[model samples]
Target: MQSFDPKLDRRRFLIAGAAAAVAVPAIAQDGLIDEPAAGTDPDVVHNISSFRARDWRPHFSSLSGGAILVDTGSRALHFWSSDSSTYRLYPTSVPVSEELTRRGRTEVVRKVVGPSWAPTPSMKKRNPEWPDFVPPGPNNPLGTHALYLGWQYYRIHGTHDTRKIGRPSSNGCIGLYNEHIAQLYELVSPGCQVLLI
Candidate 1:
């Protein structure tokens, strides 16, 4: 895991699927999703070596595509592909979880894509080179895509800083690689169920 970098505060990270509220300037490039992208690791995405076991409704429960569970404390994301492909990539400093439970399980929420990466004033204050908006790319810093967790800005996504793939990095954004984010992109959406066990 990568140590936390103040530049990319997870709290200010963008909320995906919603547009027109805040459009940061950007230099457009080919918005293409390459296969290799799905394979490369992203800085914002955390990883786990093994998974336990669980049972639940499929992620395709109508409007509920299931959920992605994340255990930030565990430094891993469990892809419960069975019950909505749960993802468990925990953020470092998540406040006391206020979420309720069902059948002794955490409630799953919607999945997201290309989650926005809105920088903090401190980020700009520290790094003047930081741009208001960074388009999606290997250097964009927000990685490629983010899996927004529940209501908070917390998420799991690709990273601008991937050197810390297996280490803790960012204010809270889980880091993977550009290619990895793209790969996850092909399988998930904003409504997929997730459990942060």
Candidate 2:
């Protein structure tokens, strides 16, 4: 089995994009690094703000069947293996506004590779110009993999748009890098526990 290390992998990911990186100082007590208020230019969104490793105990009773804790404020996801061995931390894109965010526990109800996409009813109502459906491909918003949550229209999925990572960009779902989500897809199973906070 391939091992995962949050520190080492995070360093590698940062080094690969060092040219475009900005200084990241620690932020407020809430654990979320403050960013420019909502509605700022998407291009200006920071690739990563606060990336921190967390103990799964506070969020989960145990790691049986594995556990995933998504810190929406920090724009990061933490995963722990069922045996409490492997752990991974990945920067993620969160819901754009408080109204779009959902907190509490859910389980991965399904896992799909090369998943298709369709905007939710709320999404369509807000933006009627979007297509009714999009086949699995480069243009699909769900990217290469998706972990369908117990909640309707919610997923922990990947995005082709790298700029969305570490920013509040998704309509409601949590977004990860295509590569990260692909790796996560391999490690997680359908009944894996998930918490969004």
Candidate 3:
């Protein structure tokens, strides 16, 4: 057998390794690699209010009335109530949690009247002053009613602080004014599709 050239062999090996390193991510980006699901971190506080959705009009005609669509960027939640392109637009607020705010398709998992608030572990960790639980009442963070999302720890709920509506101030949950949430609670039911974008 011919003598092996160490330098040439090493160079070839390095080039092949570099090519694979580049190709691996490309394959993964194309959905070749199985990745783990991402987790959400709860926020510490929710006291904020400023912007609001002022105009309400038929913006899109594609979605069917009765679907709930949330625009995170604008902090607006729309409930299509009729087939005639008209929809109820409510100013809403989302949590500072970016991952939880990511675009995804999920349905209303549960509906509750006068729901209580239970601080998530992460939330409590962030805010040591937060109580372990909050009872349902005028001061309840859940407000009058709550529409829980399929994802854990996320919901479209009413807030005692109506000012927070239209502000970015939650731990990943969506907040609507008490009256607005009451109307939404009546209009929606379990299994209603919720699109968060």
In angstroms, the error of model 2 at 149 is 0.3
Candidate 3's displacement at residue 94, Å, is 1.7
Candidate 2 lDDT over 1-197, as tens digits, reads 97999999999988877744433333333445345458864323243344655667767888999999998988889899999989998999999999999999999999999999999999999999999999999999999999999999999999999999989999999999999999999999989999998
| TM-score, model 3 to reference | 0.64
Count of backbone collisions in candidate 1: 46
Cα-based lDDT at residue 73, candidate 2: 85
lDDT score at residue 42, model 1, on the 0-100 scale: 35
Ranking by lDDT: 2, 3, 1
Model 3 scores worst on lDDT over the 10 consecutive residues at 40-49
Model 2 score (lDDT):
0.89
Give the better candidate number (1 or 2) by lDDT.
2
> Residue-wise lDDT of candidate 1 within 74-175, one digit each (tens)?
544444443443443322222122332111123324444555566767557767887787665555666667666554545657775656565555554555
Q: Give the per-residue lDDT of model 3 (tens digit) for 29-107.
A: 5653223235522211121232232222333334443568787877888676545354577889887768546567787
Q: Give me candidate 1's TM-score against the actual structure.
A: 0.47
What CA RMSD would you report for each candidate? 19.1, 14.1, 16.8
Error of 2 at 138 (Å): 0.7
